[model samples]
Target: MCKEKIMNSESEKDIKISKRKTSYPINSELLDYLKSYDRAFKSPIVYDDLLRYVDNYPILDKDENDTFWQGVIYGPQEMSEIHQNLKKIYSRLTSDGADKSVDHLFVDSVDYCTFGNSHPFRIKIKNQFNDNHDYFYVKKADASRIYGLEIEYILSPNRINFLVFENTLVEEHISGIPGDVFIEKYLDEHTNKIRLAKEFVKFNERCFLRLLGDQRSYNFVIVLTPDFDEMQYRIRSIDFDQQCYEGKINLYKPQFFRENLDYVKFVTENLDESSIKQYQHEERALMAKRMIVGKSRLTKLLRVMKNDQIAPREKSFQLKTEIFELLKDNEVLKCETMGDIVEAVLNFILRNYQTSMTKLF
Candidate 1:
């Protein structure tokens, strides 16, 4: 009798567990659509989702008393708003809808996973703005779990596999560097194009200085042309939403851009030792400083602000003061390049912290 009772209890528990489970599987069609966007299969969020999917992620059981969803619901009203926004974006791309088709399609996938409510189906569309233009990635506002703010990412038609870079914070800003810049060929035929090397570095440096922090891979891209010359390199920023705000943008600063002409010249010469020692030293020190300051700033800002990345007025003022003190004295203040400025600010923070600790002890 005791053994039968134990067996019965185990069976009941398994049945209850199975009944409570939810599956947010990515169907073949959805995977096909994602591939059509030409994006890397492995996204940071997607990886996290996959782990949950495989490991039987926990979700709250629906309460019988509270029949209403707690979070922001797209339920008809929000969907209309999203539709209007898409129409507006579509109209901007085309004055008249004659050139191509604008098709709205729905795929059975979780649009969002939030604390209150989750959207089980995702709405996507194919926009043919023009002949040469690429299809745009579209998404609607879905209630967020980690951050209440709507989380969305525009899918790109042209994608590059950057797995080798390990997806750092800085790499997300750039798309690809120009790949065709052979030194021998450029010198023999087109020497003027050599100036592009400096311009490329300068553009990235300016962007880096403007952001102040957050440098990682997948944020930036380096495209090298066939010749292997630095001058012919084309650099493009992939992520811009995080330009001025806190984590609101999810981007990195452009401090990693190499600026020194001698360094560029050495790279052009195929990694010669002319400025190798100085280059390596500067790179290491700058990298160390960037990590320290970036992490410190992120932690301090996060403490003061919620998911919105906005802090109270008084808190903002205090943060600014702290940051100011950290960066009051550093050689990077004199730097003309974004790369140099980042290094300078990093050094400032490190020096400040060390000095303060010394006095305290």
Candidate 2:
């Protein structure tokens, strides 16, 4: 038997994710599952269509910092066609295919980022009447990312809106303060540091529970909402490219990321062990409840995922061994895919919940 390489807190600091990950094509079963749930749609444009732009210029932030995004320019005929098709896609995303609603809407700018695995294109749409604007993304629909998005929607507190059309994916822009910006500017000024820390703890638990990895500061956002007397903070992940790909379990926990060192320190400084444990248990309980409520949909998704090949076999084997050791349950060792690993994790949580309830009774 091979020894499980479970990462400890000390080892987590040295963990590094691979620079590049192979994109997996969506298999027939997953596509059918997506179509059954209305997550699949037909779009006039595909991911390759956007790559035909002739030229591009770098986009800058308000502080004159390089955002690593380029504003792409297209030929007159191509631009007109792309813009019109994008508007139609936006209509379908937001208003259930009401094309007339987008008659007054125009594409303001199209930006592309070569930063990560997806290499997504950002589309800015504006309403001519009120000058109100919104953003969406177009990217190659990698099966791993699609599964991540679906899992986030089904399990997390947040609701995700995205549509898959052939090889393209359209996602509604998640609105919030970038995590790095929040850390730099808002962390000190936050009226309720405890609440923010608490939310981070919950967010950390959510990510690890679902095996969502590589939650560096920039990959997530901080959403602030006014709560009568004070502001409430919620952390939401913006990137899903790393979903269930890493072999290291600690990679799923955001606190282990160096980019999130500030958050980790805050959590340690403010939250004692018991408080942290309470928050973790609370999050797990909530997730268990969500699992029960979304059982049918989750079942279908997992069925597709278990049969899909989203990660390397070595990674799947390593992760399953580590998880099996950590939980002291042989069930995880039986998992052959990342999806099976996720199913095992969820089952572990549900089993623990049932045991606790039985003890209470």
Candidate 3:
């Protein structure tokens, strides 16, 4: 298989996502779920508090290009108050809310970005003795995004570190090369294109399974690790605003996005359809194992999520039909909410895998 193998796949121009997505409120059920999982607590700084900034200056990357973020300015009196609380919030997210953990840390920068849906405030922290810095983000706590984070934490290999309060969400920064940059600057020089392609297939499958949408190249990240002999690659979703919110099925799959066409083509060139399918199965089996271990927590989440309204009725039904087209399972038709749809799909995978295992014996 090569370029012609995926001649009909999507390009960047084919997809037109909404310019802005509606932010769903975190209702009581979701709040309870977060609390039960230790993901929700009182925060010293709320998202609205950060909005009281006086002005902002555009931020630039090392190449002098706009980074789509701005350095927020605040009054000196208010700045000191906010920075101290922000340091406290960081300790909560990373150190289980210990007050003394942030004594040596200082808030280096409070940057704001209005380029996307969340309009998050990026906080940069530096150590007093050493210049080593770390990053975190404070954003409006949207319920849909919370579900995405929980699903990633429960199902994916990557762990999500975050905390949520009344209307604020604090998340540790996900460190990786921007996916677009890796595709352009590192792919040609990557040590193991085949392994990378396999991971792409698995990543694509994982996104589709969880109904996590809008995974364009720039929206996610590429994590490269040096194995003893070869390079291992991983694709991690950094943005979760679109989790189970879109109507179109393709939106859930990263391979269909125009920004990811290069990876799609590279995959076609290096791997056959059978190899792609094998990787997808491997990913599903791993997720199913995780589901078994996290069964109680996942069940609690699904119950809460099904009662929460994250998507419009029309969009939810549209997605149900589209998913049924591929999965051909009647359980999908029973879904009344976006959460129900997620549960159905996951149960479908888990049940099918369990059945096969039973038959093997």
lDDT of 2: 0.89
Local distance difference test, candidate 1: 0.31
Q: Which segments of model 1 are wrong by more than 4 Å?
A: 1-89, 94-133, 139-200, 223-231, 246-252, 256-361
Against the reference, the lDDT scores of all candidates come to 0.31, 0.89, 0.89
**TM-scores of the models, in the order given:** 0.29, 0.95, 0.96
39-60: candidate 2 lDDT, tens digit per residue: 9998998999999999999998
Give the total clashing residue pairs for model 1.
Answer: 52
Q: Regarding lDDT, does 1 or 2 come out ahead?
A: 2
Model 3 misplacement above 4 A: 1-6, 10-13
Give the per-residue lDDT digits (tens) of candidate 3, residues 26-124: 998888888888998888778999999999899998889899999999999999999999999888888877878889999999999978888899999
Which pairs of residues clash in candidate 2, taking residues 3 or more apart in a chain or in different chains?
Answer: none
Count clashing pairs, candidate 3: 2
Q: What are the RMSD figures for all models against the true structure?
A: 20.9, 3.3, 1.8
Q: What residue pairs are clashing in model 3? A: 11-258, 12-258
